[model samples]
Target: MSFKTIAAILQGEQEFQRVLDCAIPLASRLEAHLVGIHAEVLPVPYTAAAGFPDTDFIQVSTELNKEATLKLRGTFHERVEDAGLSFEWRTLESFSGDGTLAGLPNVRAADLIVAAQRDVESDDGTDVESLVYDAGRPVLMVPHSGPILSSFRRVLLAWNGSREAARATFDALPLLIEADQTDILIIDPPESSDDTPDAAGSRIAASLGRHGVSVGVSVRNSQGQSVETLIQDRLAASGADLLVLGAYSHSWLRELLFGGVTRSILRSAPVTVFLSR
Candidate 1:
């Protein structure tokens, strides 16, 4: 299905506009609605046992939060307008702790979520940090410090014979269809079909070609290294601004373990990565 609405989560950071820049072209190509969202950290609940002095502190803190929200909203709106895209801007108010990713409503309605990947040291446990895992949708995570991709001219699809990768391919169909050149690069594809389960890669390429995407397909050995490093190197070497692939490769251990490629991309992704789990 085509994406009709694109939602971007912002925190009024210096790189917020860059996130917008990366998303607008996708929105324009899909002719989709764009939305910019910022979350407001609500006041911490105060109990009677905390005493009168603590109550006063809570009130002052709440006021400061409100003022910060207003300023952030104003600045965000101005930037969204400057991008020449019609956008709805909203400040989400939630009492959940920062690690909770406070804006589920925004995630619920968005077809895609655009966010800047943040590190543990940089994150104050804000909603931004959880957008990737909790959004329940594909997240096109952009690096916090990097060049904004102007267009999807060159793209690399990190393919493996897995269901997650299949889902990610479908999620990225819109962008891939519009890309100037698209390549389905399977790192160390099996020697025979027996080792590799049949996948939707070829079908996706055909579908995109029907929609005018320049497509090429190839599979190569990753030489026994972690698949993640190989994929990152391929993306950088190909000058691919967009990398589309699955988010998690395995989860049978009762815990989430990102596939090698997924983890590597998270740490040193040179460009934008569109992922669906």
Candidate 2:
């Protein structure tokens, strides 16, 4: 029940160090391998047609991008050395196409994906978006400025009985079962009347119990609070450091038309959240 491999996307010197600082501590706690990924987007090729001008455009773009990549690689190596952790750095040089990073083999091999919230106006503001969607891993998105987590002492499981929620719960088992306190909170249409005192909740609780985890379950009516608001309120009141939930309850279009819980959580959560879909 520990992370074995952690993959983090390196964007720049400052942000890369910030994410590494957050991730290395967690890696040390888990005794995990840290794999730093520098996804290098090669400059787009602009071949000049016959008699066309600007022959040096592609060469200049390539040189500039290479320089940026080298600087970032140097920074990553120094940070990894400073942390004194077993780590590996990888570089992928390619022209970014739709589904580029998604196809990366390294991303598929990692147990956890750590991402930093990037400020817009960088990389045309597309790097963060692509990493979140295409990483194909359970992403731990670190905010640009927040208290970094050393442990999942308190965890809140946002349950809705959907497949995605189930996946999220299972994916977070390592943290949940080891946490100081773990609460499985379900909010929905309402608990069923025919449901036994311990039915679905007990099943999950039992599994954790076998792991010797301190666990509890509770059901609450949404009571008109938006899912985001409800989650934030629970985070504040319970002092939970991690939240486990399904990602993207509804499709993008449907959620946009009518707010969905998953969308709200992704947009902003009061605490660190682990999501799977």
Q: For model 2, what is the alpha-carbon lDDT of residue 85?
A: 77
TM-scores of all predicted structures: 0.83, 0.83
lDDT of 1 by residue, 118-145 (tens): 6535643234425655677888887767
Candidate 2 C-alpha lDDT tens digits along 1-30: 567898876766666766777788888778
Candidate 1 ranges with C-alpha deviation above 4 Å: 28-30, 45-53, 95-100, 125-129, 192-204, 252-259
For every candidate, C-alpha RMSD to the true structure in Å: 3.5, 3.3
Please list the residue runs of candidate 2 whose C-alpha ends up more than 4 Å from where it truly belongs after superposition: 46-53, 94-103, 118-135, 193-200, 256-259
Clashing pairs in 2: none
